[model samples]
Target chain A: MKKLINDPKNVVDESVAGFGLAHPDIVTVSADPLFVARAQGASQGKVGIVSGGGSGHEPLHAGFVGFGMLSAAVPGPVFTSPTPDPIVAATLASDGGAGVLHIVKNYTGDVLNFETAADLADAEGVRVVSVIVDDDVAVKDSLYTAGRRGVAGTVVVEKVAGAAAERGDDLDAVAAIATRANANTRSMGVALTSGTVPHAGEPSFVLPEDEIEIGIGIHGEPGRERIKLEPADGIVDRLLAPILEDLPFASGDKVLLFVNGMGGTPLVEQYIVYRHAAEVLAEKGIEVARSLVGSFVTSLEMQGVSLTVTRLDDELTELWDAPVETAALRWGR
Target chain B: MKKLINDPKNVVDESVAGFGLAHPDIVTVSADPLFVARAQGASQGKVGIVSGGGSGHEPLHAGFVGFGMLSAAVPGPVFTSPTPDPIVAATLASDGGAGVLHIVKNYTGDVLNFETAADLADAEGVRVVSVIVDDDVAVKDSLYTAGRRGVAGTVVVEKVAGAAAERGDDLDAVAAIATRANANTRSMGVALTSGTVPHAGEPSFVLPEDEIEIGIGIHGEPGRERIKLEPADGIVDRLLAPILEDLPFASGDKVLLFVNGMGGTPLVEQYIVYRHAAEVLAEKGIEVARSLVGSFVTSLEMQGVSLTVTRLDDELTELWDAPVETAALRWGR
Candidate 1:
């Protein structure tokens, strides 16, 4: 694997170290039970927002730590769930006496660990809630799969929930917002190339040239099927169709559209896909109230893109428009 | 060959359309002589900032247009220089009564076209100045090269110049800051794999799985040498060494370090390199006043990373820290 890592085993630790130094203005890290917290101290009367998962999908959890985003993010190795230790530590550290909420993607390992951490934190006098994001519609009624795996919608969940928390909402209210955002979103992706997991020193999976795997999972998991390659317009239609139907985003509905590159796709390509996706949505009379197009959530050097749509009401739209300051996504001080 | 594009010939126009829609809060576009301008309109008395170049290196000129960055950006086809007409158009569209400044990278086509446009704009009663950035130290007096090519340092020039203009600096003052930023900065890059231009429909150049090309230019231009793949630490040292000596970044000097991905590199890998670069600088007693690590300037999905270091004085540091909001970069606004 042509990865920029000194040692495959040290990828997560080294990357976290690098991230802490690069964004000192945004985060502070405490190792041992590793977690990254906002540089500013947690507010005493506000709810604490915490999210964590495997490492590779960068600017996802760690890069989202700042005001108006996650208060703390616990990171494990690439494609491996963080054990309960860091999640519990993150919960306690991020707690502002209001409580802590864990935003967990619905991967089997991640769900198990975060659930255990929530239980452990609750037992220790820190009230905790977990919002599981299972927005990927690509799994599509497969009896062999674990429902749907969470994908880019975790970003929207963290963003909207963090905004609500920043606005001094109670823990319950923040948790409610997170749940609503998660429920309203759906995502699907296709991988032109597989991600090379650092430890494996090989791609998580491989596909032949001239074909792509549709309904791919974020961890480089096998998708529902391998399909012949198509143009940007066709690819968007494939990803967007399931998303639109799953969310049932109807005419005149306001929404936020996220076109995310899976690591290796360039911004130009992402924009190209966005062009077709936006046109498709416009044709359906769905107004994209807010749009994000980039590698906000990415597999490690995987060539692919995912489409995420979040149906929005005024409450969600206003919260989405609220100011956020993070290393990756920043606006409106 | 695997890219999210409808047609190779239409990539630029389609991506521009997508960009305009995605960032409507920050930019507005004019169809003819195509240019992206600040959506909120330019301040009447401030210097107008404009930059343009090939399309592939995204978030460069186009993504920088907004309140505290470029007043306008004109983009050409992928890896090809924009002609004089659009540059002239952007210069005119961005001008308030103050004047317009063109930030040109040191590619022959870009410099020639921008110079021609400047002359035309001057003839049309719009005062114009061009600041050429040639910060890459990788060329190293090679006869095969046209001296050093511009790279990531262009981002620094636009940001600092934009801040100066936002502070109501006159055209000369803003141009001077941009010029100084360019002069004080140095960059070098290493590409693990070549980028495929859309129209070309093939890889620009190929490196075997076990090798990397050091000092490669943004458009897949030949570099100083092709070497065996090295660890991230070794790679950072190679790229950062030339940048440090060229700027002669001193023991006690304050500098801003930018670790840029050439499109395809993930944020995690960029951070991994940033970690090593930061450590190397600290060992030399240089204090990194600011750090920007991401794919700010990228070749279309090139698997590479570039290191840029700029010696920062109080003026430059404050200007760098100033609040600015753009589609790609934002802070303190």
Candidate 2:
């Protein structure tokens, strides 16, 4: 209840407007349907990349729109998926002659809406394609999602796929790279506290002060397991054990490791987790070719951390290293 | 209490080691007298920028080391200023033929230690100058600081001054620009919840559930005022009023507005604060030429936001726009 917002209904409206004003050089906020697109417009002969979900996971969908990243991002309310209108609008706005690709996270609402939007765009001759990301290793089924939930690995897919698209890859090529990344990446998270949904005016869940939730979804959905809080290294091992085994990464494997903070976790702590993660990986003979540690995707003010591992090939590695100019992730630009 | 750290006693040691490992491409961490320096040493004829203080305010002195930011960063233990050895070593390591500039925050320990380091470096035949940042508009005096506490404006001073140094400005020129930036910038902050120091195993301060601390220092020192929790807009107004009045930013004035989160606040909430802040500024006819919103400098996982406004001249604006590559802040590089 100590959240900083007014009316709860206007959080999305005001935040998106504020985001557009702050990064005028990076994005252009559109009217009517409400979507964020590149301020520089579509690149000639380049495929347009579009991705979005609920608004709470910031720097994910919206902040990831700019040169070398997403061409457009359509955000819904805090945790609700956007309707088809905005998705279709974003596709239209970002499309160039090369076509457009829609990156959908694996949640029932998001998947359905984005798929509907892609159909509508393709019918209008936009040549749109959809690639789904289901990288969370936490649960096989959830109250809000079927199969696995899309967690932090979405960031990896966006960066690698965005890099490929920036290199003037065809729509199919971009989608192919994105789908491959989605298949290769796995993420799992632990939450010490639950996030309060703005409109609900209360936390989504509550736990004892000494207990913790392992494998929780970003929205505070129940995880497969809950346990007493442990030390940093032990907790990191718990999160990473399932992920490394799920990916089944072996000796001599080159990988990109992303240690992400759930909104309230500190960077210093994330790095501590990363240090242990690196040690664990080294013991298993897995070499981290590229690594990122920060809060790129987050639940609103949840104190936790998630670990995502993307086994990379030369193509994925080169794409990740390519230039990206976005509000959240920027390099080589 | 819910921090992702190993031993409370080893938080700083492990975290710094982890940071260096994660960013090997950007920095080289030295032992004996620990300091982080650019992986690619000093520029031949350009002045070097060096900074250090307590370790809790992350991405401040350490993450800002690279090509166009600080050449070297010396980190102390959490909430404790580094000793003279590391500071002297950083100054000596970063010093090129053009001399070195130490950007010191106005905290008593930091100022005294950095001054001592400058003296030591000077005796060692390295030309060194120091610029102190006291832009916090909070208390006129506090327990740990004599003047205002140096909060978020340190980021602004580092970026602009680092850019000037990167342009091969002489020692005096770089120090002068840094001084002017420190003088023109003003900041104020409010914390909804206090951050816990690891060793203490408790929050730096405490407030009731419905109460808030206004003008709180980064180290959780007592602020000038405390009041009931308010909405985001009202809170933004409260924080911005003192900063704007102190700066007396006038009509037609161009400024850089930095909305920094104190570790725990989410990006969405920060943008909401920024949205309202822009409205308040436009009402006064001030033009914001540049804006940065993130958790750049933080006090562990404190839930608060700091507002910094830097009045910009043509030279300052150009320097601000110049390409600089660092782990935290990077644009046009």
Candidate 3:
């Protein structure tokens, strides 16, 4: 695999250290290979929030750690979930005298690892709650299948739950918001080009210049469909039709609209996608209460975009508008 | 150009529309192509904020809009600044009652376009204050040249200024804070592989698998140097030594460290880089007040990372912690 570095074996360790050095004030590296930020008195009854997955997607688990976000973000290998030990360590490090909430995206490996960590944390008497995010609408809930995969909507879940925790809510409240947010949201993505994983050292898959993959997952996983490239308007219809159909969003219902770039897609193109998406929404008589069109969550250098929709009520809207300060997403009261 | 889209022309429009549909609460598209957000009130006062840049980097110019950030984000094509008409339109759409502040990232194309837009706004009797962000350390500053390019540090400037604006700080105060943040910060990036610009339909350039480009601009522009791949620790030194040398930060001075991913590197890798970077900073005796590691601002899907450091004081810290509620970031009391 073609990558920049002195040695492949040390890639994970070095990257974590670099993260601490870069954002020293908001976060600090612990004795364990995880990140912890100085909380606003974690011991003062604030529920700790911890989240982690494979490392390739930057700013997801780690960058989102701060005052109103995750307290600890564990780093695993590229595209690999953090092992049980680091999860346990991170949970321990972020224990603010209150219980800890583990926000695990619904990948099989991530769910399993986080589960193990939660079990271990429970054994240690550290109250731990696990919330699995399964927002992707592309995956069919087959009898044998685990159901839809989690995609970009996890950012929203983290922010809402993080805000709840920051407000000194109990683990139950935070996890409830997280679960509701995950349930209320749906996402679908398409890849115009396959990304090259650094370690794999090759394109995830070779695509002819004109081809595209629809319903893509964040880790360069296979999408639900593949079709020839089309206009922005047509593409938006294809991607959104399923989401709108599945969710049954009604006219005048407020929603959070997210047009996320899959690593490589440019903002200019993202805007174009947004324009067409708005047109589609207008046709449906749906009201867009808030919108985020950019690459908040991403895959590794894959040239494509994902569309996520979250029907928002007053509570979700308030939580969505609540202040947050993380390395990636920041704003609020 | 290996992209995943079915058609090149439809990419941007599709992305933007999809984003609007996803987050209907805090954002929407205006009547104008460039003006983003619902027609309803969003900004705090008449002193509306409008910013734009060539597209590609996510959550920078556009994602930072709503309650506490931007009123409108005028986006141009990938790696190209928005034209004058769009800026003027966005300015008008965002104007509440006070006027407008144009936060311009210091690139030749952006400067020129924003200048033209400011003149147009002036002609319309709308107050327009423009702040140029030039924080890259790659280029040496001398009377003989244009000085440093604006890199990722522009985000800090925008956020601080946006917060100031939200607090009803006059355009002048907001502009001044933005100017100071720009002056206090510096950033430099390196590229491990060239990115593919979708419309251009080609790799920005070819880099041998083992080599990396240092001091890169966000547009995939050539950096100051290209060298063989080195250890993450060594790369940290190579990148940070120059920044530290240039700033000559005093001992015991606090700093905000940012290890930003250039689109493609995974979180695992970013954390590893952080680990090495932290070691380097500790050796320097700098009290790191904050550290951010993630893909905050990105190049289209380049496999690389950039380091941004901002010397912080109490005021900056307070401002950094201020709440915001945009599509990308949200936080506050």
Candidate 4:
């Protein structure tokens, strides 16, 4: 378990510095201790979007900063939430006078940190709206506990809401879009191999070579059950059945099919999953409007796949079709 | 060595079918021998860009099909070239009556198959042009061979060409743009662990726990040299020095820096590489206009990373910024 790094402690900060240098026009390293928009001059009147959590998921928070996505992304330790100061710094840097929107994934640490940051921003007379993306279908949604944990579907929410903000939509409108994106998207993942958190140089969990854990968390949390590795099509069906049942997608409705890799899976295997995913959808007569596949959101180097289906309407489709220039996504003129 | 696949032979076709079901609006699939396209119809007078290689690079040729990128992708067997007929079918499916442009990555099998299809299309009086992407800096420019081979830089070429074609550029114009994008972009890769090609259920190569290889091909081809795993900053410096020297990037020029994972490398590590890449560029006063860090074009489950830099001009930047709606790249309005 060797890594190519300077110091384990400086990994995130050095990475942010590199990101700033690579896209200086679009971003700048704020002495505020994180990367902020270069156009401190232009953040006014626009509802600033700020999101951050962990450094392992590249292009999630920092790579997402640009025109239509996030205004700033505060860097945290790998798979850990950023401290309150950086979040507050990002909010202040992106406060466009209109307000700021904090999109936090429903991880406990992320939620708590973002909530505190929101409170601090309010104390400073900056209007702050927070939307939590809790789209993972793997966790049970019981009133006794928090709703399903947020997973990769957070990317969908960021894109749609970011578009709403770029279109001059008000803070309320942007928040509404974020809410809708979250409501419409559902995701579930399974880990074939547990990831070794670089600092923790061992497997996250151990499974027999023939077994895979279903309904696993992003950081290789235990899944619902262990099953023999099946064909890709069957694996896709297992993941999607719960998702479709939970969301209750109707016939003739459209969806944005996302086949996301959990770190160690190759594109070849992912395509196999996507293939079966399409078969399942067609059998149900669902119309897929657009499709996305790759490691947009990852859990270190966990060997698995997550399927996120975002039901699309005319508006969502249009927003999804909007052009964005970022390190992770780029399209539309 | 276990995989989530029923049979290796049916992987590509089944995956194509699943993709069609998942993206019906953007693509339509035929059953007899699989081929796909956007149901909205190809853009009129726009050069229909098509590309394909082995089926292992998921979300690549197939996942990239949509509004602005590839119109059709002819998928081959795993790590093998797609048959000639499928290439012809993909061309026919995407030819919008304007003409068609083929974005072929430089490989002997791919070049020959695409050339054959272009000749067949020419016989049918269809205007067809092919641009071979040979941007891998790992290969030396030798008269004895066709110079350096094309690798990850093909993605940048497809993206830029897709933007040009989507803007209603003619075949010649799109082909020219693709050629320039290919020329301006250079990539070099190195693997830590060998990728297990699906059909071959084992590691592609073996390295001890401490050693790493530099200037390796995405496929399991041998690299320029093997060395002990070093600090990320030094690793990136070693990799980028050859690319920068070969391409001769000048001071103050804008470049797109991509630190792509070879499946098994974690983003945390990729970020370390990105951080070092930025510092090295800063030391030379070279500026990166945009940077992408993720697993875009991967080589199975290889524990490696590839660095690609494309010199950007205003036109190239605009084209790069153009909005594309695909299974892989979706952003921009």
Give the range where candidate 2 chain B is weakest over 10 consecutive residues by summed lDDT: B324-333
Candidate 3 per-residue lDDT, tens place, B258-309, comes to: 7777866655566666666666776788777866666668777778889888
Q: What is the DockQ of each candidate?
A: 0.84, 0.79, 0.39, 0.46
CA RMSD, predictions in order: 1.4, 1.1, 4.8, 3.8
Query: Runs in model 2 with CA error above 4 Å?
Result: none
For each candidate in the order shown, give its overall lDDT on alpha carbons.
0.90, 0.91, 0.75, 0.80
Distance from true position, residue B112, model 3, in Å?
4.5
TM-score of each: 0.98, 0.99, 0.79, 0.87
Residue B60, model 1, lDDT: 85
For each candidate, give the TM-score of chain B: 0.98, 0.99, 0.94, 0.94
Q: Write the per-residue lDDT of candidate 1 for residues A158-182, one digit (tens) a residue.
A: 9999999999999899999999999
For candidate 3 chain B, which ten residues in a row score worst on lDDT?
B139-148
In candidate 2, what are the lDDT values of residues B198-278, reduced to their tens digit? 999989888999988999999999987899988899989998898988978888999898899999999999999999998
- How do the residues A262-303 of candidate 2 rate in per-residue lDDT, one tens digit apiece? 999889899899999998998999999999999988999999
What TM-score does structure 4 among the candidates reach? 0.87
lDDT of 4 by residue, A1-333 (tens): 656577667777776776666566667777456655644434667888998886676667776787778888887777788888889988888888889999998877888888999999899998899999988887764221266778889899999988898888999999999999999999988888887766667786898988888888776766678999887777878899889998888899899999887777876677678887876787899987788877778877778889999999999888887867666666665
CAPRI category for model 2: medium
Name the weakest run of 10 consecutive residues (lDDT summed) in model 4 chain B. Answer: B138-147
**By lDDT, highest first, what's the ranking?**
2, 1, 4, 3
lDDT for B121 in candidate 3 is 87
